[model samples]
Target: MKIFSLVIVLIILFILVGVFVKRRSIKIRRIKKEFSVSNEKSIMESIFHKNFLFFEHLNNTFKEKLLTDSYVLSKLINIDGVGIQITDEIKYTIFGLVGLLILGDENPDYFPNLTSVVVYPKMYISDQRGQNKSVNLGESWNFGVVVLSWCDVINGTQNFSDGHNVALHEFAHQLDQQSGQADGIPVNLNNDYYTWKNTFDKEYNNLLREMENAEHDSIDFYGATNKAEFFAVCTETFFEKSAVMKSEHPELYDLLVRYYRIDPMKIFSN
Candidate 1:
């Protein structure tokens, strides 16, 4: 009787696994179909081309991929606006910035664990850290949520050379959090872990030193706050001030190039 019960349990488990696999397969097929068929020409022209100077620099292939990835992300992530109405322009804009980050991946996860995005008309007050309220342009929570200020998001994209992007900075934290901790180290490094750690450590220390001396630096001074913030700040510089970063910090530039799998210098140069 026990053997029969064990067999029945095994059969149930097998059936459950089969159902899960089938559902996953169906989802993937639907995503692929949506990716291929979705049209985003109007949004590309109205939102991206008009505001995002970086969009103009990308080649046609990159542009198409960005649109597809952005569309996919929009479909996957739920975005809600607080004190503002959600619009396609806003959704595509946010997703486009994220799409740029994962552009090189053959099969991007599309921030699988991201639960939702919350946008505000402008800066919002948050006391998540403690009792003291602080104004923030954006925040990425470990609970799989990202909050943003729409005004700051537009400002970041419009000024392509500013080396400051709340979207890039916050989403970077989301990437860092994927390692199960927000300690500046990201996942999928494999054997490159040591190399990444070495470079990031050296650069992070150097930034701290520069901040102490009050010396002018290409990277943001806010990076000196912590290792995680340093990684996010470096991401901002890597994309916006690629030429300056490459010229000033070649090793760090190469590391970012390898990690992101895209050379912003080449794209921006165009």
Candidate 2:
């Protein structure tokens, strides 16, 4: 009996050691990925299979430039390249979404500092803060990476009029952080700071007051959480539910139209 007990103890030790080694290896790989750089490919990215009409209808010059930017942006991101990993598909879809998000920005160097777009298959739970877990559909880290759940991505793409997209929400956070702070203010907005601020601040306050008595909101209630989240939520709504957003909140919609440089209501109003 003593010998059997000794054997069981050894087995448990071996299992624990194996688990530790695996976890350590994963940690090492993630650290390496953080600093790793990748070479850009010359191949042009396309979403022909998805038949996203937004790109299909654009003029050739604008279309080519858009595709190139997205290809370059997606290539810079690192992810799990093995197992049931779907980074390849994620990159392709992200290429499309990124192109759509930056349509208004004239700068060719958009998202210059972003390096990674991490994605999981479903809801990504973040439990890293003080023993509390924060459940997330997507997140954009200030560390040059945007995280997402592919399931949410697909659903968001398919239901493009829902005003909720994990990819857009996270990427909008990236935009907000581009100016070095994630305060719902982007770099270069200083020129139009008063207009943007008044519009955004008023709407944010209105939502706060209204949500106190209501369960549903014309805009995502999450946008009312804070300024940073408000911007991200607005991005999702701007691209996904533009027509509805325009009809309900004309000032906010007009502000988004100017900010994003797109007549989304015209394009998305099918």
Candidate 3:
């Protein structure tokens, strides 16, 4: 009887060890797959793939820039059950490395972790009273999904020549929410929380004050409504009109550059 009980305990211990080792192996594989960097062959393949035309219209240097590694790209493109309709310049506009590199970069923490994306023909209007023909450009839900209108995507892309892209604006919200909230504060920022809060709050309120008086500004008035909107609108301009934003709102532009950890003016102006 004693021998049988000892054998049973040994079998259970071995089974538990086997399960633990298997689970650990799975976790390591998932991490490695998620963080793999781009390479020559992958870049070439991405360039030739039909879907990659999204990056073709941009300058050659920008074209070669990898928007995201395979892992991140897969995660980003897998937006939750949403339909992605690639059309017109959207394929090119979205493929441009500017927005991806600007809004997403390599940072997995404060970036679009949403697994699914839905694209529309253009500015999709939601017929709510008091709202005219308005296109609901992008919406980042807590459920790890995002929606975008390609028309707005192109418009925002072309307008990059001026200073705005609705796509970037919406995605910035997704990035903010990676920390689990879209309140303009990212989880990985190194600044003192209180300082960031005070600066953003003050600037947000000031923008609201200016918008109420109809003052001319580089950022869209929509940004004045709230902190999240402010982050989104500023991102639109950051990639679209970096020079203008840097010139008009130097402090805001600098802050954005620091937050995103990239300088579009350096990329675009170079």
Among these predictions, the greatest lDDT belongs to 1
lDDT against the true structure, each candidate? 0.87, 0.71, 0.61
Estimate the overall C-alpha local distance difference test score of candidate 3: 0.61
Q: For every model shown, what is its TM-score relative to the native structure?
A: 0.89, 0.75, 0.67
Estimate, for each residue in 1-270, the C-alpha lDDT of model 3 and write its tens digit.
Answer: 999999999999999989966775565456445445535335444533444333444455443334433333443354322245553234334434324644434433313355566666655665544547555876666566666776666555444465566666666777677777789886667764676677778778888888889898888888877788888787777777778878988877777777776677665543
Q: List the residue pairs that clash in candidate 3.
A: 54-91, 54-92, 54-95, 78-115, 78-116, 79-115, 79-116, 79-117, 80-116, 163-241
Quote the lDDT for 90 in model 2: 64
Model 2, range 70-176, lDDT digits (tens) per residue? 66455445654212376455666776687777766665344755777667778868754454777887777777877777788878877767788888888888888
User: Which runs in model 1 stand beyond 4 Å of their true positions?
Assistant: 1-28, 129-131
Model 1, range 85-178, lDDT digits (tens) per residue?
A: 9887788899899998998777777786687999999999976765578899999998789999999999999888989999999999999999
After the best TM-score superposition of candidate 3, give how far the Cα of residue 44 lies from its true spot, in angstroms: 8.2
lDDT of 2: 0.71
Cα TM-score of candidate 1: 0.89
- Which number leads on TM-score? 1
Candidate rank order under TM-score:
1, 2, 3
